[model samples]
Target: MYQLLKQIVTTGIVTEPAPHADSALRQLEQRLSETILKHLGRALAIRHVDAGSCNGCELEIHATNSPYYNLEALGIKFVASPRHADLLLVTGPVSRNMEQALRRTYDATPEPKLVVAIGDCGCTGGVFGESYASCGRVANVIPVDVAVPGCPPPPTAIMQGILTAISARRS
Candidate 1:
């Protein structure tokens, strides 16, 4: 224990320094926060609906909430219920079983709600397309304000999609 303590004291703080912040991201964060506050007068509430995804987009969404992206700090938050949501972030191709639920969630959200469809699956249905078991894209079930297309778009793209949706609503 004494030897371990001595080694620890000798090594002390060997981790690399944190990376510098991206100016573009800072600008986006500022714009998002200001837009939400200006239009909604408070933080933006989002409801995420996973219509039958492979979970890749979900991973990117999770990354946006991490300390690096810090979505909550930008005045964007995920809510458990659609009733409390100002926007819907839907992912994946709509499965037959989830189509009705997605529609219901959209209906439950208050008026002037924005929907940002994430991934190619949610946008054009990706490799899934329209099938008896799958309903194809999210737009086939509910109105979509913005579609961020990528197999699994990066966190920055997802943030941009949200920003676009909110900004469009302002117009």
Candidate 2:
């Protein structure tokens, strides 16, 4: 009875997160937006690669463009070819079978391209690091410009990482 009452009251009274906190997030997003516009005026085309993930991180990565977040508003887009990619968003721990593929993918992208390794697995191998078939993290194959650490980092975090990379380039 008491538990039910508490649940009802909490649900009734608790609103969204703090308004100021939401404002802070908005400011961060604006900062990223301004940075992208200032440094990379052109729309950024991203190519995604999965070395050997369970696909958890991939879902969140894909969600960046969907309606809830709508990363396209930030002038971001996904491309099919690595050659045309302005940035590479790589997920999962490197696998023995995928080592060459990973290298080939990275090589296909033109120089001055940024690499974003997402998820704890992509960053540091997570649970799959100890496997004999695993080749450690994404860094084991190519240099990564940004690291978004989480079991599966939120789309906002991934966006920030990409925006940061874009801002680093003067051209």
Number of the top lDDT candidate: 1
| Model 1 TM-score (2 dp) | 0.76
CA lDDT of each candidate? Answer: 0.79, 0.75
Best by TM-score: 1
Which stretches in model 1 have alpha-carbon errors above 4 Å? Answer: 1-37, 168-171
Point out the worst 10-residue segment of candidate 2 by lDDT. Answer: 18-27
lDDT of 1 at 96: 96
lDDT of 1 by residue, 46-162 (tens): 999999899999999998887667777667899999999988999999999998899999999997677889999998899989999999998888878778888899887888877
Q: How many clashes (backbone N, Cα, C below 3 Å) per candidate?
A: 0, 0
- Pick out the ten consecutive residues of candidate 1 with the lowest summed lDDT: 21-30
Model 2 TM: 0.74
Estimate TM-scores for all models.
0.76, 0.74
Name the lDDT value of residue 64 in candidate 2: 80
